[model samples]
Target: MSVDTATATAPASATTAERQDVAAPSDRARAWLVLLLAGAFEVGYALAVGGSEGFTVLSWSLVAVVFFLLTLYALSVALRTIDVGIGYAVWAGIGAVGAALLSPVVFDETLSAAKALWLAVIIAGVVWLKLADRPERPDDSDRAAHPAHP
Candidate 1:
């Protein structure tokens, strides 16, 4: 999950001065890994909240709020260099489609070739955006949101 793709369309007026400072690439990458962990932490939420008794849903709800904050922070890092529109589109699109498939696999929910095919198409779009856009990284003056991952 590279951030460059999410930061393509920074405001032109945003001079080097306005750029939110971030840590080094390795640090940024580490932060993102935490974000990823936060996401993985959410799988439990679905199981707990997807349809549970009363308090379980409330507990999962609070957990979900935390997950949302972490996810937003991670996206902000990615969007620094990546285009916001592309970044969000890919993020939400890929997430929704993947979750759809994952639910079936993990929870024994229904799945069909047709649904899988559509999800494949959507994921392909994500790959294509990554390839086509090639958003720039932060300038030397700017803080790095994520360290280089590969």
Candidate 2:
């Protein structure tokens, strides 16, 4: 049998759109994803801590520790690309709102309409934070200096 390493090792050429679908995500996108995951873990951590009852319960205590570590890891990953101020605020907001809403159902806590409204406001603020951070697309004159990548 003859070897055919050329065909096997050759790199594939793809259009920009196709490449985008298959390519590793941009730093910003990955950071946002990590931030969101961190926020979710934060909620889990809060719940676990409450369930642990000052760490007296071994199982819940372990759960709290695991979620806390995971949340911190995700936050650190996100910090690589995301601004600490914006990311931390958004992450903490998500955790707080998630925990508050979930607590009523999961831990028999109170959930008033005011609390829900305030949470919605926090979500809106986060959206604005993201929007404000985005860089505007270069105009035609500026585009000449900074061409689009293939």
Candidate 3:
């Protein structure tokens, strides 16, 4: 007459091994790498869209579509392990910073010093978010309490 909470909460097909694999450090690292790639693709997509001139340019439109698909796939993969909010904010920050920095070279756009300063702020925020996502390590107090037995 009693229900097993673990089984009740987990998906029917999920095994202990599967859960462990999901939490593996390597998997988390790979997810973050994939997220960075996704952000790169987002920059490409944004530039291509601008070059497309409202999709009038056939080549640029095609390029934009390809980058769009690539970015979406990579984002979904990363979100499997990363929190959606953190993953999305980092991805967007990368795209915005990249596009702003490259606009002059790519499209004869101007990047004023003021804009550059704001972009740096965004970059700093993204870096902080990434740092915040790191797994917590035991502090000195925790270490003192649980001394290693050698």
- Deviation in angstroms for 45 in model 3? 0.1
Writing each residue's lDDT as its tens digit, candidate 2 over 84-133 gives 78889989988998899898877878989998899999989988887765
lDDT tens per residue, model 1, 1-150? 655733433365664223323234454445434434433444444444453444466765676566556666666665554456666666676456656767876666887899889888887987786566442557655435444322
User: Per-residue alpha-carbon lDDT of model 3 for 17-123, expressed as tens digits?
Assistant: 33323345777788899999999999999999999999999999999999999999999888776777888999999999998998789998999999999999999
Which scores higher on TM-score, 1 or 2?
2
Best by lDDT: 3
Model 2: residues >4 Å from true position, as ranges? 1-25, 136-150
Question: Given candidate 3, what's the lDDT at residue 98?
Answer: 94
| Residue 80, candidate 2: alpha-carbon lDDT | 57
The runs of at least 3 residues in candidate 3 whose Cα sits more than 4 Å from the true structure, single-residue gaps closed, are 1-22, 136-150
The worst-scoring run of ten residues by lDDT in candidate 1 lies at: 15-24
RMSD of each: 9.6, 8.2, 7.6
Candidate numbers, best lDDT first, in rank order:
3, 2, 1
Candidate 1 C-alpha error for residue 135, in Å: 4.5
Ten contiguous residues with the weakest lDDT in model 2: 15-24
How high is the CA lDDT of each candidate model?
A: 0.55, 0.77, 0.83
Error of 2 at 147 (Å): 12
lDDT of 1: 0.55
